[model samples]
Target: MADITDAEHHIVAASYHLMKALQTTKLMSSDVRGILEKLDFHLSTVVKINEDEPDGDSIRELEKSVVSSHETITSLHLSYSKVWASGPEVILEYLEAVGEVQRSIEALEGMPLSRMSNGVLEQAKTTLHMAMERLQNELIHILVQNKQCFEHEYPVFEVYPIYEESVISNEDDSVEDASLKGRSSSETEDCAMDLIHPDVVPQIKSIADTMFAAGYAQEFCLPFTAFWKDVLAEYSMILYVEQLSIEDVKRMEWKHLNSRIRKWRVAMTRIIGVYLGSAKRLFDQVLGEYDQVSIACLIEASRGPLFCLLNFGQAVLIGPHEPEWLFCLLDMYEVLADLVPDLDTLFSQETESLIRIDFHELLSQLGESVRVILKELGNRIATCTSTTPFQNGGIHPLTKYVANYILCFAEYEDTLPLLLQDQEPVRESGDEEQNMDGEADPNPACALAMYLQSLTSILEAALDEKSSLYRDSSLKHIFLMNNFHYTVEKIKNSKISPYFGDDWIRKHYVKLRQHAMYYQRTTWSSLLTFLHDDGKVGKATLKARCQHFNTAFEDLYKSQTRWVVPDPQLREDVRILASKTVIQPYRNFVRKISDSIGEKHIKYTEQELGVYIMDLLEGSSKSLSHSRKR
Candidate 1:
């Protein structure tokens, strides 16, 4: 026991030390076990040395001697984690150190350790291989077992599409090649995540259809949600393929798509006996169901195939999107168009014409009913927020928008009516015989947009708390700031207004924006002063001051994007405006500022302010964008 200084002495003696530790209530060295009162500094050093080494016989022998050392270590880690969690830098460093040791074990095992110089070395190598293999298997098992956990968490994305990477719009071949210049492995790994590959839609569809025919039960809704996990897992190898980029999803084979569309098209023409499939007697119930279904349809319409329908229905109807579902939506409109006559048919002529009544009012009443649902949604957000936001994580923004709307505004039952309609094809007065086109009733999307802006403005004005959200705040601080704005926005926009003007929501948005900007500029100056000078806060704290404002701006981007009723893309243009105007240049500013943070770069305020303006315009920051395109 001559001072376990040599590597072999520390490793070999660890086994006996563990054996001694297991026999006593308190851990003790083998020789000192009989003397009940002394500290075992030698034993602690041995264990520390063991934890750092590649997995080997010495560590396992020590672990086996100690009945519950693994559990004890976990407990110790947990007890101290709050302190480590507070400092992300330390936590990351700790994980990295642990990971490096594990990586070394893996590399050692891969070599011809079977032919190591000594019997102990060969045994240690074999033991390490077994441990690594077991760990990998355990990870796979856990992921498979918890497949439904992800679904339950991200239900909003059940029908929408998810892109693994941001779509790279860069078409320059020179930049594409040169972009790999002077980049580190970590940067390359990050870039690898952005590549999107074409989906095997035809194969998935064929397999699903065959499986269903072979009596396989459908466990989930939507093709993507059901198959996405395994699909993503299997294709994960694509992430490791250097220089090979998986591109965006390409169009499905027209041969397969057209056959299916043609089948549905014929069925629809024959099945379309009435206006809304079969909503003759219970028009009210049918309308309600339609509202739910359309909302679901809109969820689909926001991504993948549905995105094409909403965005490019006229151009690629026969091939990618097809005209049938579009026709179905159109026919659903006809059913509503028939509502006026159907009411007359059911009752006497004196009954209030469901036709002459304002469509907006009917839709507004429906929207009001849906608003009551938001309370439950808010509670859920409060509960599972770390894992899932108000809208689930990885879910499409529009999907979350729909879920949050339903959750928060449960009372405002019918929002879809404000979005869709069916009316008589009225042409030039005398020649109203063939072509069917009518004037826009009120443009509910316009109204929804207005309400979102107004609501966001209200939050900005009330909270006039931060100058920039991302810089000065932790995610927790940013979340608090964002949540405050969220509550105000949901309250204002999700519910309908009593004021009966056509553009009431629009007016609300305008007023809210004006008041918000004024209040933010006026109040934030004082807040900056309060946070900066009085408390002697660090640069990080000062940087956090900007987080609230960044959050507000994100909410603003979401509001403006989702506000447009019939034309959601019109709102999407605002994102383009936000990017071109604020983000790109400020991002460059952040790179410079971030470099000089600890060593007194440019002023923290300038960087904080710049980052705030930039982050707001770019993120999926608000609760969820509803009333607009995804």
Candidate 2:
């Protein structure tokens, strides 16, 4: 074996200098020169090891030097002042490692005398094998440490980039030509609604400069790239697309706030970009990628503003206080629905996707997160655990917007199609962009409106005028229990999502917001009944509260038409309620109760609190019977 000191010398020296390089941000000529000199030292040693027989000594030296070079390169990469600063340098280091082995092989076996020997072949094979292994380890380190670089899928949502005629031909043109021609008109319109401006380049560079100058990047390269790559500038493209879409809105000069609608669509694009990443690629087919031309078209259309066409539609269709916004929102929903199925498939099936959390475990986590955040937000809004409906800012802003949009858009369900095709024409794609504005382009029905109506049915039950469960404490609890079942079923369904996604969908948002109305309504009703001081109300109301709690279980069990099997405890608890109390006089009273006017404001809250209780209780008889048979 090689002397331990030699290996330590290589490793310790590299580590120490890397620490120094990472600590210093002022890459004065001297600093740059010093790091360059250290880089040369590691490169020289690695190259020398590759040329040698790679006995234990040489192998150790190679490993140590490679480790140090990797460290230094990684540190420098973290502090990249511009795009060129990091990615290019990393590629260079990779090239250097590869080149060292190639150079060593060439040097040792160039001549005829050297090439013909079996001894040389054997030694060369061993050396190359060792070198490749080291290289593999290095590559693995880079990928694991910097997986965030590839984390976002926004960039990959476009069509394929390149293809051959024998493979992905699009009828008339060669694959290359066809791909080059790029995205469909409506597709480009979607893309344009998402592009970022080149103008932000200078500002991004400036921030990089400050970080590089401050040693922030060197100290934390992974986080540095993450902050810039994932957070700060990632949505720049979306903003650019928004601006471009506005330009289209200006060109069209349509009536009734078409420009404003464009703005909202642009905002929507940013929201998607925040979750999905900037890389756009085509769906993987059995043969090869089919997104080539479409991918480019997506990027180009997104080059202006995101969803400009939606904005145009909105401007044309919706007027303030008019019923048309519902229709326009439905159109947007249709487009969005077209985009969701593939995304759902990707999360459910793709190995590297972020949506790979276990649902039950995730739901558990969401429960805890929502409690903490909603309470905190509740505090901010001057509310509490016992506060009644219409509190806590009336749904978090994003949720409010999405839900209200869905609710309003429900009216246009008839106008939308049951199924939507993914491809849509953009106004840009050269002459075709203008041509799409013409009446000749097929104006298809939206898919969003239909989905929204189904969603509306669930909420409508909470808000309906004649519903007995809307205000009755017992009714409210049971309805919320049913709602929880409904929501869980939605989570399991093929369409729509309970969350936006892994990185962005805080566990708190789902539990706190989705269940907020139910939680508020039920909790307030339960508490008020416990503490109500009306003189004549006495035991009658209190006993009814208890029976209502039990009947709430029955209501929840009935709601299980949506579930494959209602959670078992729900039935057991209902059975327990049957044994403990006889509600001879109250059954008719329970039947007579009507809907609460305040239900709409507190729907999610009541549902939240009720679901929690159901989780704690036993299931109805049907659920127990089914379970026992199973």
Candidate 3:
């Protein structure tokens, strides 16, 4: 056992020494790796330095190029003051000099500035700066000299000829003509306005390229943006877009304000669609090498006028929510909606996203305003009341106002759906299926239809309340019948008929007929009872009944003749219906009673009664006393 323990201790000691030796070796290996990596890095740096060292020939060539470019820039700077006055060849030489300096600067960029001797690098930079300054001045001069005169009388709504089929059918036109013909009016307008003359674009682009190469993009943008901004402002003034605040709009009378709103529509369309679009094209043409810079330039230059137009819409949005303003709001909404695509295309860059967002928010606010105005109209109609009823049971003012208002909405059928799209339609009981047509989500048109239906229903309820002001029940029915008939007929004849649907018209027509029937029953039924016999056998009784009939008939004729049914067709229909109801029964009773009581007891022949019934609703008062054959 002692020998076995001794061997175990010896094995443990050997293993411990071996593990210590292995760890020492690993540390030594790590030190060698660190040394090797340092050696490799130093060797690579030496090789890179040797490789970057310029040869004598290349250095001489760079120096020569710099000297030549400097000479060109210095010579061009002498003529800078008269750059525009000089011929095109001088302008061309100046642009070439600017380009040569830019290229020399680019070639020097690869060399270490410290390597150049005798201030060569500094001299080159100074020469390039002077060249860029000259180029900048030349660019401004060319832009100013070539800018197209602002034509104040430019047509606001000119339809381009290429959009017409006559222009499209010409086979001799170029590819550009075909492309122009294919473009929509808005797209055509995008390129229609030229800020600078076509001859100057190439010269401007050359200067722009030189400036951009020399890292003077900001300097290039400044004058271009300023010139276009002033032009856009002038264009705004020409379009009659006044710089009015919300307070200004609020204070103006509606007549003057209406004119301004119309001008705003034209101005917004022209500025955004034409001027901004043209400016974007100019930037792309001049600074096509730098997209971000060009887009930034456009946004900065036109931000003022663009937002000026948008702020007008915002001002109108915050103005009063009167019923009369509804159409104007719709007009603004439509114009904005139409321009959204153009705005998206023009302002799609990240820098111009804020303008896009502002427009979207304005569009949303205008839509909300329209909804508020429409809801207020409904509220006004619902609460509309009168202490005095219409004198002759003609169509009520409320009905006329609402019918005309709803018909106007039909004119905006294409635009209202987008505004009303987010609203959950108010579904009266049993209208859900009709409105949704078995779909869970109703289309925008359905929502608009539902809204119109609700409005008309509110108007009907208002008319119903107003009808109670009439003291006579027959005139109340006449009032409702006339109003309902008028509303239905107006809807039936106008463009809004589809939104109300055939079912709605048919149902209202039924209601109108019911009111007519009510008028007949209430007015003529009582008078009809006089003609009926109650089993009286004596001739005196018959003669007394005949005299009572004549007196009641004459009184009814006098009072109701003055009442009106303004619609001629409706008037004829009402008369014919009364004739069928009262005239035949009246003729029979008069004929039967006249045989027993003699001709003197019967005051009116059936022919005379027919004539009187025909004149019942003619809106005139007449007396039969003079014409009575006593």
- Tell me the tens digit of each residue's lDDT in model 1 across 177-287: 110001111211111111111132222232333223222212211332323324333332222211111121125343443333332222222112221122222222212
Candidate lDDT (C-alpha), each: 0.31, 0.35, 0.73
What are the runs in model 1 whose C-alpha is more than 4 Å off? 1-400, 403-503, 510-630
For candidate 3, write residues 489-601 as lDDT tens digits.
Answer: 98999888898889999999999989989998998888787888655668888877787888888888887898899999999999888888887888788767777878987
TM-score of each: 0.20, 0.24, 0.79
Please give the RMSD to the true structure for each candidate, in Å: 36.7, 28.9, 20.8
Ranking by TM-score: 3, 2, 1
Q: Please say which candidate is ahead in TM-score: 1 or 2.
A: 2
Error of 3 at 282 (Å): 1.6
Better of 2 and 3 by TM-score: 3
lDDT against true structure, model 3: 0.73
Lowest lDDT 10-residue stretch of candidate 1: 175-184
Error of 1 at 458 (Å): 15
Query: Which consecutive 10 residues in model 3 have the weakest lDDT in total?
Result: 174-183
